[model samples]
Target: MNQSTNPSEASLHAIDYWQVVKNRYGVILLTFLLVFMTALVITYVMPKKYESTAVVQVRQKGTGIQVIPGMADASRYQESSSAMFFPTEFAVIKAQKTLDAAIENLDLVNRWNTDLETVRRTLKGIVDAQDIRGTSLIEIKVRYNDPKDAQKIAKEVAEAYRERRKKLQGDYSNQALDELRKAVIAQEDAVEDKRKLLSQIIRTEGIIYWGDPSVSGGPRGFTKADDAESAAKAYVDLEQEKIQLESQIETLLRYDGPQLMNYASGLSLPDNIIPVLLPQYQEQKRQYEAMKSQGRGERHPMMLSQASNLQSMEKDLVEAVANLRETLKAKLSLAQEQLARLKTRMDVKEDDAVKQGIANQNFVDAKNDFETAQRLLEQLKVKEISETMQTKITEDPIILHEEPMISNVPVSPNVTLNLALGAVVGMIFGIGVAFFLEYLDTSVKSLEDVERYLQVPVLAVIPKDVGVLYKQSGMSPDAEAYRILRTNIEFNRKNPEDNAITVVSGGAGEGKSTTLVNLAYICAQGGYTTLMIDADLRRPRLHTFFDINNSVGLTNYLTTELMLEDVILQTPVDNLYFMPSGILPADAAGILNSRRMSELIQDVKQRFDLVLVDSPPILGVSDASVLASEVDLTMIVVQHRKLPRNMLMRVKQAVENVGGHVIGVVLNNVDVRSDSQYQYYTSYYTYYAPAESQPMPSPVSSQPSQSPQPRAASKKTTSADDSKQDLY
Candidate 1:
């Protein structure tokens, strides 16, 4: 037999996983059932809980207060400060002091079946506050075993928070009011002092006010009279200058009429005519006008036309005006010079007066602005002093109906779930048990199992209850299975010359002898002339089946002086013979090992077409091994559920040790009906009719029927001659 190879990692993993599934299926099922039951129990037994909640709105405080520099806007400061204070509120609610107070107020210790410490712990578990999204609101939730208790606790906590808020806000408001009052008073005093200083400065400066003395009034300035006086004086002076210039120009034109006419005549001349004749004169005149506008002399022009024109015009006008004023020559010169001097003096005086008036007006306006600012400051101070701080809760933390106190219905323990889990577990367990039994079983139940485990061909499978072969001397279902064994042997024998086979078993009572007898019968039926030897001297059973005398069988022939023919007996079956065990031998192994036994087997093998030696179980004694070493082929018989696989291997080893080759394994005493795999092979023989059912003829005197020789005293004989008639 070939050695089994180790399975690959994947194959081993699969096998191991399958084994675990098989072995632990029951445990898994039980665990599932327990888990389901526990869930169900817990669902039925656990307490239900209810929840309650309150909504509290937080509002900024001291928003109305107005403070000095370095103090932020009251509303902004309060909002920012609230963040720092909120955690304090949360800590306060969680504190033992607050919890104890709540307990005392509600008398929760007695009402809730708890001491102060336990009540505190329960309160800690139940109460929580969280800020509302996008708003200054907090949601307070409480959970309790009782619905009413949950609601009551939530409402009470809300009420406590409201009271605390009101107290805090009231205290803050009082403090702010005191500080505001003192600030207002001090500001009022400062405003009064500033007002007095402003009034004194106005009085010392002698400024007059025209408009209302309030900041909202239109522009007011000190002394409008002085500005009006100076503006009127300047208007008078400009009017005088205009009249003087007009009169002087008119006088010049009238008095110097002839000379002016001569100058105008000279100017009237066409530039084309005058350019060559009076070029210098025109140039002097043009230069004189241009230079006069630019405050320069008339001789500046390159042609000198302006200077020459001005000199000629001046001489002519002077002469004409001198003639007109010959009688008052000195008066004319004096009058013109006096007019020029007066004009200069008037321009200087007007400029000085305008400058002085602007300065005075500007001073008065500055004084008025300063006075208005002082007045507004006084008004603000008065208002601040009169005003009082007012604080109010913008949005009160209201108990919008307390949380709904409804208990939950736990649905964990489900009977259906448990049953389902249990079924799955049970199936797993059943498969595990099946595989475990398969692993532990060592007996050969099928040809495949035998071939796979032992790496040997199964010669045959002998159906169970083969004892029927002894009762009905010929073929039976049990006998048919062995005939199949014989056929397989005949076909599988490597050498046609090797016809002597030994039948051995791993243990006793595995149907080895029956197999040998039946196989011999089958061989004989096939016209092979078969002989069966009961070589098990230790416990001979062949004589009993053949109804032959064991007194002078194989052991007697092999060990003593008995002839081999004396031990060979013919059975009722035609062409089938048996050699019984002879009387039990003390040294069965020793006798079987002798040279005579070998000679006997050799002799029989030569006489019969097939010789089957029925030896003792190989595992039981050395008899089978001895026979195996002498025979051409050794066949091992293993009963279903008889010996373990290792023990059978030991049997094979024993045979091999004796130089015997085990041709095949014969799985014996198999229950074909129970094990349906073998039913096909065992079923046909069950319904088959024996060959004896055919017609038989009476025996006639074929050789003058010789007188029957006295039958051997210890041997029983049954006739196979069908034509013989018995006469007793």
Candidate 2:
């Protein structure tokens, strides 16, 4: 026996999800239709609307006027210009004053028939403004129930904005011009005073007086010639000092060489010695030459003494000359000093000329400034006259183009979207319901469920409303299923010697007795000697179904002193017999478990080809289990959708616990037509239905093929000699 690895997968085989869809297809179609119709109705009932838009450009403008001191400078003017345009524009766009004016001009409150509060709200709704990104543009749009009304409102908003802008510009420009005029006048007066002071300084300083010199030239107060003479004398003195320093340096260089020559000649020094001693002799010679120029000699008595002095001096000079150098450093120093003095004197004259030139330029600048101020004042006066003459649109306001418009096709009543969504939602709900029903269903509906839950092979499926025992009686097509079950049982049992079968179920109404009777009928019709025993003593039903006498049945045989032949009765069907529960036994379990009962079952097994015992529901009493213990194979009959799974399992367990081998399960009363998956087998009955006019199988054999054996020939036959014995 191969077992499934996953019991859940095995269980799923019983519940076909697609079959659920097929069975409940009407529900799904109705759901989709309802949702689609609802969407269409909602879409048809919605309202429509219209929209209109207007466009406006925001431009920046600057007035040639100043509001603060030095505001005319390009940097300050640029900043002020930006400030003027932005603030005024924002005020025109957002100010309640401007909005109210626009409302009044357009007669919006009257048109809307609104109060002050409503008028404000209406204006706000109709108008909107925002600076276009990275540009100076604005868009105004409005929505209304009527397209003409939307266009009218949009145009009115634009006109109101233009009027307000003109007024704001005029007021701001006039204010700026007035302030600028006063500042320019004040600046002009200050510039004139600065020029006068500069002219006075030029005259008093007695500088070169390059322009208009006669203003101070009449004075002997200061003369250019006198100053020039002083500067010349100072220059000459510095030159003379420079010349004397140069002459002393030149005289030292010229005489020093000749004295060194005299010293070298007088000593008769070697050429190498002369060169080495020459420098030292030159120093002494330089001093001697100075003294000789003042009338001293090398060989006078004074010269003789001087010669000795010279020798000593030469020795000292040699030491001094080793450290001395004729560098001419002092001459360079004196010449640099003289040159510095000359440059300083020249710089002084240049300074005076530069100062006079700076003063002249200052005077000219002041004159020009005064003239420019006069010209600006004239221009402002002209502008003021022009502005005063012109009319200003004093109530302009900014307008925006974009507005919130309700769509004619409402965004909410979207038919296609809603229907699609409804379909998905409904499918989810339907599948949930299907699975939920599957979870609650406890009956054995399919072979897979019976096998998985009961752990038994499905012996047969009895089609629902089978008319086998009624219409054609034994010749009905429904009898075929039972015949198949009989064949399966014979094939499944390993030993032909152990052929006593007991049929049982979980509950009373599961058709166990009916199954036994019909199975016996089919076996007998197939030429096998078959007997059905009504072992359900609690409620005996087999005799009533077969229209046989049940007063002298199994209970009578067990309790009375009677022969087995007296209790058993031959049925109307051929080769078939019924032994009903004679009378309800007080202790059916005890009676069924008696040694006599075992003997009876053994006798029937040998005498008959097949003996099917119909026992009571196993769960309701101990009678079924007691009979199960004595039978060769115990088969359970489960009515589809009648017994719960746990109860069915309990019935199987009861039989097994009593040492009975459960051969298989029979699924009874299955609705084959409605459940399509089962229809393949049951459909044959409908397609090739047997005619109601067919004859029933004969109760007795048509012809005897073998000799009828006496009781002595059977291995376990009961004696039938006492024919008058009381069975009940």
Candidate 2: residue 86 Cα off by (Å): 22
Best by TM-score: 2
lDDT of 2: 0.66
Candidate 1: list runs displaced more than 4 Å: 1-311, 314-416, 436-456, 461-483, 544-552, 640-647, 669-728
Where does model 2 exceed 4 Å of error?
1-15, 20-340, 343-424, 440-449, 452-455, 473-477, 549-551, 585-587, 590-596, 671-728
lDDT of 1 by residue, 1-728 (tens): 12344456667667556544543455556655665565566655656567777777665553434443333444546554655656666665566665666677788988878678888888898888776666666777777777678777877776666666667667765676577667667666766666566566556555455545456454355334445455556556656655654554455456444454443334322222322323444556665566688766535564365455566755654454444334234444555666666666666666665665665556556555656666666655543443332343243433344443443532234456655665665565556555666667666556776777777788777777766354574445556666667767866788866889998888777878877777776565544556778888888888888677788788788778977667877777655677788888788889888899888877876666678888887877888888999999998888876788788778888988999988898888776655655677667776763565554222221211112321221211323231112110
TM agreement with the true structure for every prediction = 0.45, 0.51
lDDT of 2 by residue, 1-728 (tens): 34655776676665577666655566656665665566566666754345565667654333333333332335424634574555455456645776677677768777878787787776576555555566656666555656666666666666666667766766675776577567657766765766676566656554443443346553232344445556667777767767765664554445554464443334321222444555555565566677678786656565565566668766655443332323334555767787788768756765665565565565546545555665766665554454443323232333343443333432334567767776776666666665666578776767888889877788889987654363253357787788668877876777766779999999888888778888887776665666778898888888887676688779898988877777777776656766778988788899999999999999988777678999888998899999999989999998876888888888888999999999999898987755666888676764575566776444332322232321111222323221101110
Q: Local distance difference test, per candidate?
A: 0.64, 0.66
